[model samples]
Target: MTKTFVIDGKTIPFEDGQTIMQAASAAGVYITHLCHNPQFTPHGSCKLCTVNVNGRNCSACTFPASEGQNVTNISKELNEDREKITQMLFVEGNHFCPSCEKTGNCQLQAVAYHLNMTDNHFPHFFENREVDASHPDVMIDHNRCIFCTLCVRASEQVDGKNVFAISGRGIDKRLVVNSPSGLLKDSALDVSDCAAHICPTGAILIKRTGYSVPIGQRIYDHAHIDAVALASEGEAHDH
Candidate 1:
């Protein structure tokens, strides 16, 4: 007998040690998320993948799937909360989509479109973060960072280089370079490192490759994030 759980009335099978997010993805069910790379350990910081498991809200990316468990992912209240979270992320960062090179390819931007976010509901923080152009092959635009820590984890776990870390606390939390000069150029990051390409926003970009793909022909411009994410799961895992 196969064990399964219910998500929005759809039964999803799960193997032992698999998370709710993993099971749903395997079943072709989309769960909105950020900071969740199948190649790395799940960090439930983003909260965009929050789902009601047995009537209790939990992060689908980190929550384990249990037999006969009930999960609610699609609901009016949940969608509204997700939209608010998405909006807050926009207001908290300097995400000027039109001017950003990662506009259409950005996961954050794609998720916002999927959620139908038309405006940033909160007042803008307009943080005066720095743009580090010290690296010859890459750039770090801190202003657009949502602090998802994808780069941090990728560098540490996959690349075996602790090049990035989070510093401060609460609203003061920010990404930091692991060098005495606090510069990416001093770190061990190469253009091919997973950390270099794992950023969900334009915070970390490969120099000279910006606008290589025309605006109208970008990834999300042609397909929804759900499909793109599902299709990229294998590639992401192999990275």
Candidate 2:
């Protein structure tokens, strides 16, 4: 059955139980979002798609639409909030896109561009992180991780292997392999494992295909976050 709700000043009908993000994507009211792969479960850690639902800053990826509910995806308040979040992602880690392999195609970079973030307002954490190159097909750089948990969830849900898990306290939390060996290659992960392909950063790069796609053909090659946001709007119109 379909339910009626308000989104960005428009009253629209959506299927009951569908997430606000799904509903917005269906309606083409695009919000600047990353860390949400429709192919997998929503990991609202990015905070890029935070929308005001009945005055709460809830993530669209996980929030269900309700009858007569008001959902605001883009507003000054939300834009500022998301911008700060984007800034945090930049400074909290080392996101030097110019030197990284995933520069043009990264979702984190795209969202930053969409939010018009040219400089990080916060102090850089500059934490010392390690890279795991033990896996034959993939590399894991802990420094680039924003703790989105996409890889951890993907491993369990899509790859059918529970090889990744989160460990540690607050700011020091890290992704750990579920093996005594600790190394990714020693962790018994295959090339086809979701852990090899689900990362949004250069952190978990595939070993051999590093330069397969040229700079221009990358996912965000010609598009900025603003362009993506606009494209989402156009896509909504197609529905």
Candidate 3:
């Protein structure tokens, strides 16, 4: 039987046992979320896509959608909170988009522009982290990570290699590769590995194509994230 849930002031039909995020995506309702990759199990870690479920803040990516459930996706308050979260992410990491490789197509960057964030308000932590280039094919740049956990989830769930694991707790937490030796190449990941394909940033890049796309033609080259967001909004309207 098909069930219906109200999303963004409209009734959306979805089946039982489907997540709100999944239903929204299928219904073309774009919810701002990270760490809830369709390719991997929903972790709901980033909490970027939190929505109002029956008037309470809840993570939409993992929340179950049911008949008659009232889901509020877009709102001034929720949008503000999401912007604050994105701002935290911006200040927490060294996401200097001009210098970073994943400038435009980066989901975090896209969402930031969607939120109209011009500058990071908070002070930077500037934690000294090093990029591990031991892997011949890919590099692990923890400095650029927002602790989204997509990489970890991708490695463990999608790739079935269980190479990446989170260590420490709270702000100290960082990704660590599992193996007798502490190296990504030493782990089950190879150059053409599936785990590397799901990374959203330059953190896990294919060595061969590192510089293949000229700077001008790269994904984020011509557009600031706002243009992409506008284009996406236009596409949604057209559809």
Q: Which candidate is the best by lDDT?
A: 1
Q: Provide the overall lDDT of each model, using Cα atoms, as 2-decimal numbers.
A: 0.92, 0.80, 0.76
Clash numbers, per candidate:
0, 3, 0
TM-score per candidate: 0.97, 0.89, 0.88
- The collision pairs in model 3 are none
Error of 3 at 202 (Å): 2.7
How much is 134 displaced in model 2, in angstroms? 1.1
Kindly provide the TM-score of model 1 when superposed on the true structure, using C-alpha atoms.
Answer: 0.97
lDDT of 1 by residue, 1-239 (tens): 88999999999999989999998888888899988989889999999999999989999999999999999998988888999999999989899999999999999999999998899989999888899999999999998899999999999999999899999999999999998899989888899999999999999999999999999999999799999888888455435
Candidates 2 and 3, the one with greater lDDT: 2
Please give, for residues 1-239, the per-residue lDDT of candidate 2 as tens digits.
66788888987678877788777767666777767766667878777888999988898888888898888877998999999998988888888888788888788887777777788999998888888998778888777888888888888888888888889867878989877889887776788777778787777888888779988788787766556655654454355
State model 1's lDDT: 0.92
Q: Write the per-residue lDDT of candidate 3 for residues 66-184, one digit (tens) a residue.
A: 88889888889998899999888877777777776665557777677677878788999888877888888788877777777777787777677888888999888887888777877
After superposition, which runs of candidate 1 have C-alpha atoms over 4 Å from their true positions?
Answer: 234-239
